[model samples]
Target: MAVHHETAEELVEEVFLFGRALKLAVGNSDSSLLPPALTGVLGMLSIHGECRQTELASLLCLSQSALSRQLSDLVEWGYITRTPDPDDRRAALVRVSDSGFEILERIKESRVARLSTMLGEWSEEQALAALESVRHLKDTFTDQARHASADYTLIAR
Candidate 1:
């Protein structure tokens, strides 16, 4: 069935509010946790695997210079590597290091622990339903984003 405009608007509002709540709740915890911006960049790199710096920049919707700052920290922390692209002498390839995967796992565990506390009262079935819904929504949006990536203008680096 076709989605109604009002329903779509309601969904958008809910998503915005949900995102805000997530940020306010879980995004600010733990001094050791990486900043949200870097975490997001790392997450993207994890998804894309080893890719050229320029290609990663394009995929991330960030200019090369902006991406460089984040990449620098990742490299320093041994979370990721930037090496010469063998196929392209002038280009660099980016890949998440083993430590990067470990950090990502830690981040996931911490976030899940916090969220689980928040959902402590939920029944197993209720939690599973919520998980299913979120996964479905995420997959749908991911597909949409890939299709629309070419048309999106970078708003931030």
Candidate 2:
């Protein structure tokens, strides 16, 4: 565990940076079914697929009661489906629905459209150069982060 409160703050700062990067890269259009507040939850589900509610809550740093309420809302909206976990009958597994996938696709399309509009004023060479620079920055961060404190790896997703 990290002994310093500064570590917690730094971790949070990085998460915010990631969120900002995502907003810039994918256009921050919030679908009614998948509101901005719930983006991380749904995005995690989208990336990891079905998972038990307890595990999902742990991953999201949420309480089981809180996650259950949120999941209920998603299920009501048809954005996600909930089912009994096969291995644990008492537990539930949540998965994104087809409608959820469709909404995600639409959001991605909006991101592409927005990116095009933003880059329209830039010359092709300028845009390409910016892309390469961003890629290198990303690679540098990844490479340097490999030697971070072992606890960082535990908390990093």
Model number with the top lDDT: 1
Using all chains and alpha carbons, the TM-scores for the candidates as numbered come to: 0.85, 0.63
Pick the TM-score winner: 1
**Candidate 1, TM-score vs. the true structure?**
0.85
Worst 10 residues of 2 by lDDT: 24-33
Compose the digit string of candidate 1's lDDT tens values, residues 21-74.
998777766327687878888889999899987888887889989999999999
In model 1, the clashing pairs are: none
CA lDDT, every model vs. true structure: 0.86, 0.77
Clash number for candidate 1: 0
